[model samples]
Target: MAPNQDEETLESLLEASKTPEGRSRLAASGAVATTLRHLSASSPLTLPYLRLLRNLCAGEISSQDSFIDLSGPDTLASILLSSAASVEVLRAGIQVLGNVGLAGEVHRAAVWVRFFPDGFLRLARVREREVCDPLCMVIDTCCSGVGGRQRLEELCGTDSGLRILQEIIETALKAGYREEWLEWLLFKACVEEQRFLSLFLTLSSSEESSTNLDISLTSVFKPELLTTQHAFLLDILSKCLTERPKEVTVSGKFALEILEILKMIYNIVDFTTRVNAAIPTGSPAIDLFGCSLLILRDICAWEDARPTETDKDSLVNLLLDEGLLDFVLSRLEELEPPAIVRKSMVKEDNLFPVELEKRVCPYKGYRRDLISVIGNLLHRRKRVQDKVREKQAIPLLLQQCVVDEENPYLREWGLLAVRNLLEGNEDNQKEVAELELKEPITPPEISGLGLKVEVDEATKRAKLVNISG
Candidate 1:
């Protein structure tokens, strides 16, 4: 049969294998062995066909005899090992073997590890354009425990398996692949199954240079990819913090991960610097939306503790340099409450708590540091003025400040920054004055200025007026 016909047959078998009756029929019949034999042949098989057959053999077949009868389970394993199929097919085959749910088959999972040294590494070497989506799907599905937990254990135990996973991470750092995909794969391997947490720990411990991460870092800053991946990386890190907290220690590794994520956001302001960037100017609004959400999430994440001056400066420079201050401001404005006085909104239990808010609330020094960042950006020379339109920039930032003021500390900072802006520039000052004159001005009394001033001024005036009269 042609590879396409084989693929169709495999698909039919897989669909049929979904039911117990179908699975039993597959186990009882010779169809699976025939497919395995065909897969083992020198002739090329479509990736989908190989994947489906692998899945069906592992999942539907219950008896060791079914696999063992194909010249023994070892023979079937040899076919899988030698085929050197695409990562998707290999992963599918491994998963099927795992799904057999027989402890005796654990050795087959181990065989995959022994046979495919750096499976992920080889996959990574392939041009991402050629393999990224398929490889990603392979990682995604394989890590899903589609085969079973024992199978995962078998794979993880293999040195090659661990290396492959590490390669995936390294590739993610270098290739600038989608963080969501990486996160999904990692989460499945480490968090959901707990099979690859040790591998993550080992990789995190290894003294790999940041150079590997630089390409992806640079790519992410590109306007189009930046927003989407930035949000994705943030979500991934946040989930890691919550789900696999133990694997992610409070070491430099964790800090590095956080910093990498922050760099992506910081890079957004200058996304046009590279020659062949992923995110170009005039990208869709969805990109902006993703980028904005990521920034907000990061702000919320670090809202509590005081960031070191170095961290603060780096972040500010990135935001100011990239022209992201306007984007940040815009998000704040969008979150503002309606002017109508309505019932007080109560917090819903189902809603995830904003971890950033809680972290920021207690740290006065941190709040000051954040305020300084906003102030500095408000004053800095615009780097991409032509692209961003300076005339439209300050108002957008001011709107963010106004809207963000719902948090008392953020509100205070926003008001003070606005004050600095309105008072700092002659034009802004005039604008403020004009606006003030148009509206009623209610000034809060300056604290500690004595009522004695009012009394003494009145007495002195009375004395002078009486004498004059």
Candidate 2:
């Protein structure tokens, strides 16, 4: 047909793509195939046809279905990879790819695994802001897909794909566009895929154990490059620390696994400012540390009588080296009163505690969480128990158990921690036997003040008597 007829036909398709019913009718009449043919046959026709496909697939699954039914992506990918393809065609094609990938992971994986080998990744090299950002966004959304990390890593490992990806990440970060998603992708790729978490441990490992790490200067992954990525990671972490996480799971942990991984990246004890910022002033600090302690509790716990080191480097050891136990113990020491007061309402034991259990905890839930973390720490690792005993944790722990007998949760965890301390250790049992509990006696509450009868109508004078309860 003539150029005018081609223009008219492309215009009709573009108009049809704007509506669901129009797209369906175009699909039924094989108009999608006709458009794809025009896309490949006429270089002048590429942008209009690509625009049609992009609009068709934008929020409408049926339009994506119609495009997929015509094998539109392969045609687009082939055109994209061609050296003769114009910059405009490549730009339009990347947007269409993003739209298709957004349809779901299946379409995403197809586009990624096929074109990413050299097509789209190389397209990112284009310096045009319009093209560069859409390319990065396409990769970002694709990385979030089901098999994205694995496939992207495979491609990255083959040649300079990893470098190109890192470059893209750095560019996006410098431009300040969706840095968190970029950080997560980089983290998953490096930490999960490249096993860089071990490398990080080696880097942060204390000076004394430096000899045992066996890390070399000529390592597979360079430290300096990893440091650049880590700097961005730390930036993301600082933000999470300031605001209490809004999403939570049934077990009272952050809902996102990415945040969980970020948790493992660095211990909270070392970053006091960051950890303090993670919770509100009135909110208990226990929730922040409790989650980490719970994970450590699971790691160190044993089913049989024998405990095993689950990893080459124990997370518990990491916590220990970071002084996590000491931090919690010290914080508890700071928050604890000279005397824990239990009301004489229930005469359980002759501990001689104070009149009332003063409001020590900033929030209620923190009480149980703090003790539970400590209790779990004592359960498996004899090292932790030994440390606790050396730190004189028994007397303070016992006080918490008996001081507020009404706090069932605190009492339960405190009791369990005390039990774990004494279960297999005779020394701890003796220490507990020798422990002394004392509660300070406080003055009675002053009830009211009243005028006395000394003003017996003789002198209009008023006398006040103080009443006590």
Candidate 3:
């Protein structure tokens, strides 16, 4: 038989495999073994044979069995790893493997045993859409089960494997064409598979990360990817938290999943804060901290956004029960005064430097973020408001109502937090009313703006007024 005739035969078989009966017949006819044998016969016949194999195995368990039984995975992995193979051949081979992977756990394990940790990572570096898209499909399928997921963890345990994964994520984020499979692969590997800490460590491996806060995580991971995943999580939690109590109730399993996710976020925030005394001004850790707080704030707001008359396991209540409010308050107490306030209080004549706390929240808007979380927690929850008064947090919050250069919007967030703390709570309002009346400290920025803090003798309340008044 001529080579062209063989190509024509393979193409015919590929077309026939579109039907279920055709696929079953093709699998039963021992044609899979013949194609694997001929993959190395000539470069010209390889693509058509691979395409035929791919079509046969797609969504067909018997055909996939034929491919695996005939040692097709090993043969294809060899071709993909061969130096003589062209990009076109590699892409087609990968598509076949991806199809085989879609069958089930057994099929996926076969593919992972051959291509993973090196073959797949190498192909992933090719950077072409034709190859990367199918590669992503293969990895995503392989990560769908316990065995395959364990194999992925092993692959990522190596330094080279971790680097390759980072490159894949960074490239996918910056690629001209968007691929949903790549996103799914990342979510599977990082979120579902619990590989986020590993991937995060890989991204933070740069030495300058220790000294540079201005460097964005985009230097390693793309912002769009982070934003997309965060939004995805927020949307899911919103739906879960805001469901009407009468229609359907939030389940325990889902609540547990959400609690675990919240714990992870809190750990990231806690870990970053503890490791560094002064987080760099624009460091990735700072963004991570801010993002974590923002997620917590949004979750709290969504949990309280719709109040139910009946007692259910609410996320806000769960957060409070977990002492998230106390945690935030304790963190706030550890932070050094914002840069602007600290500068205003420094005495020019004194030679001694003020000793600062070792654990400092150095990021811009750190105060505002902490305050935002408190504000959301206080929303429609009288217990949180009363807790704030009991904790003596009201005075600390009032102190935030000054113009601080470092924490943008600190004043606004402070006002909002105070409002939420006192709303519908007479005890909190009375606590604020009984506080000693003292003049507010004027930062240089406020003084430059002709704004001065004044105490009204009649009302016995402090207010901002023009210097002329």
Top-scoring candidate (lDDT): 3
lDDT for each residue of candidate 2 in 95-185, tens digit (9 for 90 to 100): 8888888988777877776666567656755545556566766776777767777776663453345545544544554555532444444
Regions more than 4 Å wrong, model 2: 1-15, 40-46, 58-74, 78-91, 102-109, 127-161, 178-184, 187-227, 233-469
- In model 3, the Cα lDDT at residue 68 comes to 87
Worst 10 residues of 3 by lDDT: 274-283
User: Candidate 1 residues 1-469, lDDT tens each?
Assistant: 3334655666677787666677677667665566655665244663554554555555453433455455433543454445455555545554444444343434344434433454445654544432444455444544443354544554456555665665655555456564345666655555455443245333433334321222333433444333232233334545555554445423323333333544444433332222122221233222333333333333323222233444444544454445445544443333322111011222452222222222111111222223433444444322322222344443333322322221334544545555444432445444434433442221111111111101122222100011111
Error of 1 at 322 (Å): 26
Candidate 3, which segments miss by more than 4 Å at Cα?
A: 1-3, 6-12, 84-88, 156-161, 188-195, 206-290, 294-383, 387-469
TM-score of each: 0.39, 0.45, 0.56
Error of 2 at 137 (Å): 5.3
lDDT of 3 at 346: 56
C-alpha lDDT score of every prediction, in listed order: 0.41, 0.52, 0.63
Error of 2 at 8 (Å): 8.2
Measured by TM-score, how close is model 1 to the native structure?
0.39
Model 2 has an lDDT value of 0.52
Which digits, one per residue and each the tens of the lDDT, describe model 3 over residues 1-469? 2344665566678888888888888778866776777777257777777777777787788878878888888899778888777778887888898888888888889998887677877886676777777788787778776677576776555565666666565545445235556656654555445555455556556423332323333344443223332333333234333442233333333333344444444434433343322222334434444555654665565444445533342756776787778878877766665555566555452422344543555455677778888888887688888888888877666666666666678888876776777667777765555553333344343444476544445554445568785
TM-score of 2: 0.45
